[model samples]
Target: MLSDLQRETRDEEIWKIKILSEMQRLKISFYFWREKTNNNLSYTSLMGPDKLKILKEFDLSAVFQSKTRAEQIRALWNQFYKLYLLMQNKTTTKKIFCHESQAWLDAFLAPSTGHPNKNNFVRGMYRTQDVTPYIHVLVNHVGEFLEIHQEFGLAAFSCSAVEKKNHMQVCLYFQNTLKDGGHENSQKSAILEMLEHENQQLYFALNETPNFFEAPKKFRLE
Candidate 1:
């Protein structure tokens, strides 16, 4: 006979496989598997949008058939989806943080008071799972940061743009700059080439004019 802990572990593994299969069927592109060399799952490609989609769409009903556990998981996911939506809030011109959303964050990070409330779901989760460092920072420090910067919202502190720029630069370097003989023939340093590429992009952007007129109706543009 299997021990209780072993059975639980087996069930969890089976559930993970089912979830992954479902996500694949749904064409969700977030990474969930461990790399060959590393035991931990790669989160480098997991962006805010991916997280929001997974939280919103990934069904926990198949994994947690128990009413109590399913309800708890749903509540937790709903809280996460709300948090992501708040973070992704944008103005007409650009991304902006809304201070009004902090109330939801506070509710999410609230301590369990032994009553039936939003905090109870998080409390139940904490009881079952180990709190990671990211969770600790989000629960404790995020609110403090928001308090310190009352004028700014969470979007102001987001690193998405920086990450995107870095990814673009890496692609440029590998595909365009370092192609022939690993940059031995080129007179310019890799850093200088990258700088030049950025300058050229900026120049083009500044020189480009916006076309205010709409395309003709019969053009059949895709």
Candidate 2:
């Protein structure tokens, strides 16, 4: 069961995947460049006020000019990569898909792991070398997410009870309904209903005891 925040993160990932697929399709057809003449007016004006507002929030801008096709693609990738990191504001180094180091064996048993007889050291060393450039890029791009995750210890928060309970109820409802010839649309409706019920339960519980976190009440010195 994913918490509301996790669901938001998943939705963002889905949106990024769609955007990246479109970019890849364009890249294959050389759509980002203009043949015969070096003009980028369309690119510069591609995103109007709404997009500019979003870019301003993250200190990002569309690169409308590049000397080479490779540079243009690289710029696009960099922009999307930064956007991805910004959206996923609580990711760990282990979760970084592109350039994660695999040095667990070496860390645990350095002398034995680094021996010539063992190939673990060789594989780990080469993998590190191959991804060195990407590692640098990730470090520069995702520093904000890393910093926030570390500062807040976001991973410490487990899936909320309300979310898990709702998930279980929905799953049970789906399974029971399936036996009665329930369809996909019905399953979705059932899940939504379960979620609504859980939400109301949470609202009532919070109303009954507002200080759920047990925060200390302030007292006047006078």
Candidate 3:
């Protein structure tokens, strides 16, 4: 069972996924509300005025802007990535996406999709030479897509330690990226014409890729 705060976080992630799934008929507006904590560095992304309000209570300003529904889709994907990272912790420098790493995540992920694989109706898992310390980025949900939802992806990296010790340094891996809300390549006009900061989905990518570091989550970042 999730704690009260964890439950709230789950709600926040779910709402982001839902509201961003633009409906041709229902137009939804999202805003940053506030949070009870005052830790500014604890969060990666979030959507909804209520969640923003919760974040703001802790001095974290969360906001998103989009002119078209496509942008809104991107925004939703962005928030989930940020929120998940804010909640997870980094502890080891083992190969990310390796059998061991996947084991830990599978416990949490399997309930949803019967565990990821490298095929359709399933996602394949693997690592790439993205960095040193044996760092590997785990990618899942690379191809699955629904009509109105974003496909998700995950990655992990090892934190550079002080000694550069031949010994292993702990790693913080990012899990979960929402991309289905992405607009088609042909929608180039709208994407190019959209507001630069608001238009670029880079933040979407940033928030999706979880950053692991030593932090306290006692009261949701106060």
Candidate 4:
């Protein structure tokens, strides 16, 4: 059912083209706008739904409060990445919070050892500014990840990571429009051209061997 271009390309390659590329562009632009304006702009802000049901396998209703399910997942991954970076930092002098944060990180790292999924029931923790209650958020995130892997393929995680990145781009493009004296229509076309050009340049820079995450071999695609 795949076209020649689609068939020849690996799943991750196809994912890059169809998802990551666009998401990265948009997310970058969005972050630029936020930096320039110092305002928090998000997909939920522009669009009413904080999350969207891109795929309809699991019930995300429990995790989401203000954001939609998809948005919640994006927030979770954002937190996960931030936590991951924090954990990876090998600085000499550690903060007090770092000690507590490690325990949280361990919980995320070891989701199988405890009954995190059944005990907690919060999915939309990303909507808050506080990081103290991250355990609940982490539990929801891991639960969602496992559920998604069980029902869909590992490609779904790839898809999600790409989308999370994509959220930044369109906002950045808006900032470009502001910089160009609010020529919305003309600036949009110009930005699109510029994005395509840069994308091509970056593609060659990657040396044509796109790095991809390993697929979870044990999970069956539902």
Please, what is the whole-model Cα lDDT of each candidate in the order they appear?
0.56, 0.42, 0.33, 0.41
Q: Write the per-residue lDDT of candidate 4 for residues 1-222, one digit (tens) a residue.
A: 112223334553443344334435344221112334666422322231212222222222322232343354454455555554443333312342345445545533432233457744433222223334556544335434434444453333445566665665665555533433436575546466547645765786788744455877797788
**For candidate 1, lDDT tens digit of each residue in 7-113?**
34566466566666757766776445677886764433556566567677766665554555556657766876665565444321112223333443454444655
Residues forming the 10-long window of minimal summed lDDT in candidate 1 = 91-100
lDDT of 2 at 108: 17
Q: Clash number for model 1?
A: 0
The alpha-carbon deviation from the true structure for residue 93 of candidate 4, after best TM-score superposition, in angstroms, is 36
Per-prediction TM-score to the true structure, in the order listed: 0.44, 0.21, 0.18, 0.20
Model 4 scores worst on lDDT over the 10 consecutive residues at: 48-57
lDDT tens digits by residue: candidate 2, 1-222: 012223335454443444435445443221223445655312223434434433333221122111232233344445544544443455454345223222221221223235677644421212333345545545454444455555554345444787787777767676633433456576545555656656776887888945236779999998
- lDDT (C-alpha) at residue 73 in model 3: 28
Cα lDDT for residue 138, candidate 2: 50
Off by over 4 Å in 2: 1-98, 101-144, 160-172, 175-188, 199-222
TM-score, candidate number 3? 0.18
* Candidate 3 residue-wise lDDT, 73-158, digit = tens: 23333443433343232322223323344443433233323445533333212123322242223323211111112222222323
